[model samples]
Each structure stands twice: as structure tokens, then as C-alpha cells.
Target: MMTIMRKSPINVRAAAKEASHERIVQAAARAIRRSGYDGTGVADIMKDAGLTHGAFYAHFESREAMLAEAVDRAGAESNGFGARVIAAVPAEQAFQALIQAYLSKEHLAGIETGCPVAALGSEMPRQAPEVRRAATRRIKEMIDLVARQSPDWGQPGVHERALVTVATMVGTLMLARAVDDAALSDSLCSAALKRLAPSDA
Candidate 1:
């Protein structure tokens, strides 16, 4: 006779908890992305996830906690965007690849799937402290990556230059999304990229 091995109940419970938490986070991210931070509510997010509001406290302390998680998710999603471009091109060409990809017609039209910085930048300053902190960290991380691609920038004032670059990218993308004229959208992206382009490039 052979004896069968059984899985630990603790491991199963942990996996279930992780899956539930991830589902809630994803649902919150979608809700917040479609509706700005102030416009969305805990109930709405819970409803979207098909979970009860009572269940929320099991994973987070309050709405602010969930918002922080959502912001972190959005930030990660936004920053990871440049990875594909950076991988395909040399570091010298990385910035150009980013500019082109970000300014492209497809990106301009795809608001739901586009960069969160471009989608939600105007709303960041108004978010709760925790959410704002997450946004700040993500923004800094992205800037550091861009500065790394630009060797001449040095390390001292990367923050300022990164702000300019990020601002240009977000502002132009927002303007492109707001307008009805295709030509105007294209021009806005082109002009912004030119302004933010590195001096050496």
C-alpha cells in the first residue's frame, strides 16, 4: 500500500488570500483609471470586483490604503512601458525610442491603455498623501531611468531635467487626447518631443 501526500492548509489559504488581494487591487486600478481619484469610491471598486465592502478591510486598512496600492500599480504599469523600447534599442537611442513610441498616433488614441502619467498627471497633485507619495516614487524612478540613458546629464540635476522631459511627454499626450483634430495631435506630440529632446541628440 502507498500513502498519499497532502498539501498544507496554510499554503492554500495564503495563495487564496494573495489572489483575492490582487483581484481587488486590479479592480481598484481600473476604476481609478477610468474615473479620477476623487470621482471613484470604495463601494464602486468593491462592486466592480464583485466583492463586499466588508471584505476590503481584510486586505487594507481604509480607502486610502487601497488608493495607495492602486497608485503603485498604475505607476508600475506606466514605467514598465519603456522597457520594451529600451530593450529593442541601444541606450543612446533609448530616449528617442521612448519619444517616438509615446508620441505615436496609436498611443494618442489609446487613452485606456496609454501611460498613466499622461492619463492622470493633472490629478496627481490632488490625490491623497499616500497616493501622491506613490506617484512621486514612480515618477522619480522613471526619471532616473531616462537620465541613465542620457550619459551627459550627470547626476546632480537629473531631477529637474527629468521633470521637464516627463512634463513635456504628459502634457503633449493629454493635449493630443483632448483635441479632435488629428493633425493638431500629431503637431503637439512633435513639438513637445523637440522641446524635450536631449542637446546632444
Candidate 2:
């Protein structure tokens, strides 16, 4: 009698499911960051992930579900950026380091690898409810990171300052990206950074 050769269907199913799901989430995050929430469609995200649109529902209950997961992953990936910014300087130099990093020419030109808030914040409020909530939480976490680095600031006022700092950084980048004049863009970022720098720094 010849022995039967076979593959384990359960193991194969598990591996395929994990790979496909991760692919979909990664593709969605990239597309949403580049295109904003409304601009990226499920089909396009699936196509970019090398999976069929029909496979989307197997991983996500809806586009909103995918967006929520994508936002969370983006947040986690970006979680260390602010901490890294502050860690690279003396206490007196922390704010300036952050300012320079946020406003630099490299940041203005590199959206895909930089701040997700700068890339996605304007459209965030308009996103699906789940996406909006995820974005809001990520923004809070970023603010908290900046606040944690500054011991000189009052506890109550730290959050407000963080928000203003983030807004200025994001807005400066947005304006810089919009204009045909490269000089104007650089000037706006430089001015904002100068204003936000700690008085002693």
C-alpha cells in the first residue's frame, strides 16, 4: 500500500490569513498617509497589497475598521519620533532641536516618512468616526511625549503648549508644500521655528 502525502489545511489557512491581513493593513496605512482618508479606496489598497478586493472583508469588517487599525499602526510607528527628537539634545536645547527637526527642508519634502499628523490631520475630522477617534488618540499621545520631555513647563499648561507647537509645525509644513516658491516655504518654516524656540535657547 502506498502512503498518502498531504499538507495540513489548518496550518496553510492560518499562514495565509496572517499574511493577507498584515499586507492589507500596511497598504492601507501607506495609501491613507499619502492620499488622506477619503482619497484611498478599499480596492486600491487591496491592489497595492497584492490581494484582491474581495479578500478585504475577510480581514476587515469595513473600510472604517481598516482605517482604525491603520491609524493605530501609524501611531505606534510614530510613537518614538517625538521622544527621539527630545533625546538628541540638552534640556535647554530640546525645544530648538524639536523645532529644527519639524521645520527642516527634509521634513517639508518628505511626507511619507515623516509626521502622520502633518500628512493626515486636516482631513482627520472628516474621516469615519472610528478613524477620527484613532487620530485624536494619536495626537494626544504625541502631545504627551513632548510634554514628558519638558520638566520646566507647568503641568496644566504643557498640553496646551504641545498642541500649539504641533499645529504650528504641521501648518508650516502644509503651507510649504502648497506654494510654487521654494524660498517662501523655507521662510515660513524658519520663522515659525524661531518664534517657537525656548526663550533661553
Measured by TM-score, the strongest candidate is 1
At residue 147, give the lDDT of candidate 2. 64
lDDT of 2 by residue, 1-201 (tens): 999977799989999999989888888777777887888899999999999889888898989999999887777666666568788788767767777887888878776666778788788767789988887888888777766655557767887888787788778888888799988987998789878774455
lDDT, candidate 2, at 155:
67
C-alpha lDDT of residue 68 in model 2: 93
What TM-score against the true fold does each predicted structure earn?
A: 0.86, 0.84
Off by over 4 Å in 1: 1-5, 151-159, 198-200
Full-model lDDT for every candidate: 0.80, 0.80
Give, for candidate 2, the lowest lDDT window spanning 10 residues.
146-155
Give the distance in Å from residue 146's predicted Cα in candidate 1 to where it truly belongs: 1.4
